[model samples]
Target: MAMTLSTPPVPADWTRHTPFSDPGRHAELLEDVAPSPEAIGPVVRNLLAHYRAEGVNMPVSSRDDINLRWVEEMLSVDQERHPGRSLQDPRATEARLQGCCRDHTLLSVSILRGQGIPARSRVGFADYFVPGWHSDHVVAELHDGERWRRFDPEVAPESGLLPDPWDLEVGPGAPFTTAAEAYRALRAGELDAASYGVAPDHELSGDAFVLTEVFWELAHRYGDELLLWDGWGAIPAPEEEMSEDLLALLDEVAEQLIAADAGDKDAEQALHALYVRDDRLHPGERVLRFSPLGDGPVAVDLRRGEDAVTRPGIP
Candidate 1:
């Protein structure tokens, strides 16, 4: 029962809607990539089965806590097997049932659909820290009478509203280009609470998204050449080590933020805290150090400002 409808794509309108503003609207302006209704269904059933096998129950209502518990458990299971690939995209699907954030969303959508409820996938920058250089999030929308309901599989109702994906409170505002840009701005103090907006009761694990990004950078840059172990190879580091990179990236981003203001003193000072003095601003756990160019006993701290921190292997 999937039909392509023509409508202006408005992804960030956080308020839920039913039957869509336009019944024929299919291509959401916010959706860079969309899944076929058919594609979405199987993904959901697979997730349900996967979790059900592990003894998880579906949410009876829009209980954030229950949903979040499911999300955490799902991620934990996936992390145990595929630690490096935990995102909210279907592209990261490893098995019929297992997937990243996107996959989870798709699964949620399917569950809603199975109940004869029309649901759609919403993709956007989520401020909550998971693991990566950027924030990407997925959630399901259900049309319940007049207004649609916003449901987050990743957010636990009990945990409350996770941090706004960009720390911007939930409301209508000018849309930003990418989540990374939004995050960089927030980090640099460019976007104030008033500008970016906010979300209610949102929670995040800073290490998850930050570390994922760092590990990805390392893998791309040094893994193939095996520079870390004298050509031995680059194995994906742990979560804490990966988050350490967030500090490094944040430092650079902070400088960029200052530069955006034409060398504003405040921005420059902020950058100084991160770049100069090599203070371990956010020192991550110290892991077995390895040289990027060659074999050497170098301490690697994924945390920002750690002297051991080096440039990421990839952009």
Candidate 2:
């Protein structure tokens, strides 16, 4: 008989989290998150048709020209959607026409990377014409002839100034203190995945500090599901159990990191505090209120609670 949910076997390779380590195996596993390019052909065609109809010339010579033309030709100035509402897939680029600003830009990065172009993912807050409230953003950068040129997969003409990675201001403070500080800043709402020019594409855990790179891969697959957790294992869950398997998976990751001495002393200490001890973990039956912002992404503010620890103070 076919395997059913009642007798579900834990997947074999949650332990391995590498990017396309085995292209064949990865392709098989990613069937759920990424669509095949062939299936997306129609979408790409439509995007290209739209651009052509508008008389916007798409260029593909040097990376810079290609990036510039992509920005200028593909995207419109009408800002209707927030960045987070739209869904993304690795294979969306396979569509002949490309997608809206974000879709096309992500595809552009994938295509350039496929062609062996040296590229890097950028993520952080975006402040274009909009102001004050920071929005999460992602993009790609390529080394054109002499210098590196920034590219946005989301914009048509691809015109926007990406602040220096260290220069980004999330809310009250500079979100990241170091290059890898993004891992922490994300939870505090100080830094966003897009600010790094790469979509985070996953929710993550605090214990993830140990196998940082590996965690990034896993989180990417389930961008919205992973939570910022401290410990691992099938312990008594503080919140409604989303998936016991996921909890167990995190436990396994924590064990691996602790064994490997993955993160810094603070991270190690935090992990221990969260799992081995229960005091650091939030107690059950406490309501944490977040104020719904009328304008930007939901700004979180602590209304009142005895269990509330540190309010994610957004300055």
Candidate 3:
């Protein structure tokens, strides 16, 4: 009932890009890069800098609002920031695109796929960032022929969080815990919900945040790869009250995710079936984006490129 899974073989779809990870016109930027994390991690680090960490002191105007959800948009911003610089070159902290863990994972995935490698992003809580605090995070996983390997492109060698940040071992005692694993742990009274969330000091730490993250993990697994703040369907708003029924549904979801991740063929099929049938599990055409930059909640049309409709009073 821990909802943990062993590493499984890579899916063919993961070798390709989803709408969020696709580099579009800038796909050329990722070309010629080696598929291994050793080669790709540095490129990702150079192209984008963490808004809160490396670029924290950046001007208010430049920070926060620039969490480019799409890799194409991120690449566009990078080009505008530093023209003619190759992806391998070091970008000035100011020139790097401002984003969080998800951006790092997505860009890394895009680059890997471009090099014909099977890669995907994982949404979970990383306990390595702060002692006793599990912050919501995203990491990339690539299939190196035999099995899947998880890595944190956002973590640099200087951080000293892991022996090698490019390759990470996840699960029980490991630094990272998938949302499904955390959910199962919470239900079993093995873990405290309050300890898992956005940050140690942020107000968004609780059971509800963990529940939303279960859906976040599923979405990423199924190729949606949405931004950390994007919410749709069954994903609850911070103010919304959760009913007993919704919690039950999430319990079932966590179970399926765990089994599927372990390469249970039947569980994989069932999980996909559940995602397709449940609007609560997968996003629709539009989603409510809760911007961390204080832009307020707005309805984003997935079909419309970068056009966010300001729907007043949509909590």
Q: Using lDDT as the measure, which candidate wins?
A: 3
Candidate 2 stretches with Cα past 4 Å from truth are 1-102, 120-123, 143-150, 156-180, 186-315
Candidate 1's displacement at residue 291, Å, is 26
What C-alpha lDDT do the candidate models reach, one value each?
Answer: 0.34, 0.30, 0.77
lDDT of 2 at 163: 41
Tens-digit per-residue lDDT, 1-315, candidate 1: 433333222221212222111112222211322333333433344333222222233232212211222233444453454455423334322232323344455445434433444454444445443322224444454454433344455443344445332122333342212333444555566654322222222222242333223222222111111111211122233333424464566546434442522425455345434433343322223334443223345553333344232322111
Lowest-sum lDDT 10-residue window in model 2: 1-10
* Ranked candidates (lDDT, high to low): 3, 1, 2
Q: Distance (Å) between predicted and true CA of 220, model 1?
A: 28
Q: Give model 2's clash tally.
A: 35
lDDT of 3 by residue, 1-315 (tens): 111233344232676667777788898778856667777778888877777776655666667535567788888877877776779877777767778889888888888877667778888899888889999999999877666789998887787987888778865697888999998988888888888888776779887788778888888887788878888887777888777888999899899888877768787777767776787788877788888788858887766356332221011
What tens digits encode model 2's per-residue C-alpha lDDT throughout 244-311?
Answer: 55444554544433332332445434443343334222222222221111122222322223423221
Write down the RMSD of all candidates, one decimal each. 16.4, 17.3, 6.2
Clashing pairs in 3: none
TM-score winner among the candidates?
A: 3
